[model samples]
Target: MRLAPGRAILTLDLALKLALVVLLLLAVVFPDWEQFEGKAIGTRILTYPLSGLLVPAGWWLFFRGRPYPFAADVVVILPFVIDTAGNAANLYNSIWWWDDANHFVNWGLLTAAFLLVVRPLRLSWWNLLTLGIGFGAATAIAWEVLEYFAFIRNSPELETAYTDTLGDLVLGLCGSTAASGLMAVGYQHRELPARS
Candidate 1:
């Protein structure tokens, strides 16, 4: 099945994701920005950027779009609003790494997403899992590529880069799985009313 075909309107999550992608590309395409910031960029990112910009962005995105009643809107938003933000935090590399915490939480979110989209729509589980995992894996690779290029210019240690990349993939898979589960469970129950 295909996503609803329409102009892709702007979302807060979309904005943050776009910013992260742009930031990585900018640094990779031009590595001098690392020193230009005098390492203060890292501190500023941890202290402010993630909380100030990214959180608001995710909150906006999570509530921006309208999804079907009893659908897995919350589940699908879980990745962008919750898990992906955590990933972005790690990318800044300024604070404690929480991939371990994000790992299973993302999986649960993905599971909810899966239930939301596929289950209610009568789509096959196999197809849902495949597509979700494929998307997550692709993004994971893209994030790694971004990081690798950034480090190439920033002159970070290779081992650190490798670890970061690995962490990204692991979390990506977890998020994907949780989203898929959400699709699986979406609209399956007619038991309760959703929040207004």
Candidate 2:
């Protein structure tokens, strides 16, 4: 049968969260798992649980008594799921385009989640676009810095790291700009909440 849209989204969010949990457990329990090694395992151990915490954190911070933001939660959780799964499957190395796609799509997902969470604020189009893109760009830069310090500094990947970092940043900006622009346009006609 079919599920309602919110229910379906909730289901998907739960499933993704479950997958992350399983990945986290594997990382902790079997740090030598064939699918991940060295820094990869450490990354998973650090990232997975933190990724899972975002939804509840957002709820506690922003959506306390309101309806659960399942769709927003999915948007927030999906990129981490995709990244972790890709690593587990070794797709980032095997599929030449996977990393590129992740850079673009994950940034888009993050920006979209930010917009969704803030929708009730009824900000103007310009404000939404600015904040969304700013958040995305800042995150993209932070992620690159993390990579540099975490693993890329000493790895063979450092040889092409400059170019790769530039491209990833550009892709992330494009993705976020696109998502923010679209969201701004869509919300342009809605009246902003009146200031007191």
Candidate 3:
């Protein structure tokens, strides 16, 4: 049997969310797991579930009784899943470019998700660009702050933290800008909602 497009996307989204939960649980249960050794398990345990719930919560809060945008849900949940999976697989250590790519791609995913969530607002292209980039920049800064406190502050990685943080922030903002530009252009013609 074949699922409808929305159903298929929703299925994928649910799968990613489940993977995220399982990964978190494994990290908690086996703190000695390769990636768990020097990582921020506590912060992840607290935040990952909340991050996973964001799309569902937004749907309930903003579009109750309407079909939640499954594609958007997948987009929003993917970054968290990818991040967790990367850590679980030890890609960040085994692969030199994993961390950099994660920052860039995750920010792009986040900015795209933000655009999709606010589409009902019928905001102008410029407004979308401004808001999306601003949101991405803000989140990147917040993430760096969290990283500093969670691991960098006391870790041997502290020596290179400054350069790494700066690079991550720049890559994240670039990703956000690229996603915002694509989304803005795609929606330029439909900036205003049609009258009934």
Estimate every model's Cα lDDT from 0 to 1. 0.49, 0.84, 0.89
Sort order, TM-score high to low: 3, 2, 1
Ranking of models by lDDT: 3, 2, 1
Clashing pairs in 3: none
Please give the RMSD to the true structure for each candidate, in Å.
10.8, 3.8, 2.9
Worst 10-residue lDDT window for candidate 3 reads 186-195
Which residue pairs overlap in candidate 2's backbone?
none
Residue ranges of candidate 3 with Cα displaced over 4 Å: 189-196
| Model 3 Cα lDDT, one tens digit per residue, 1-196 | 9998877887898898899999988888888877877788888888888877788899999887777877778888888888888988989889999999999999999999999988888888999999999999999999999999998999999999999999999999999999999999889866566779
Tell me the spans in candidate 1 whose CA falls farther than 4 Å from its real position: 1-95, 99-122, 151-153, 187-196
Model 3 TM-score (2 dp): 0.92
Which one wins on lDDT?
3
Can you give the TM-score per candidate against the true fold?
0.43, 0.87, 0.92
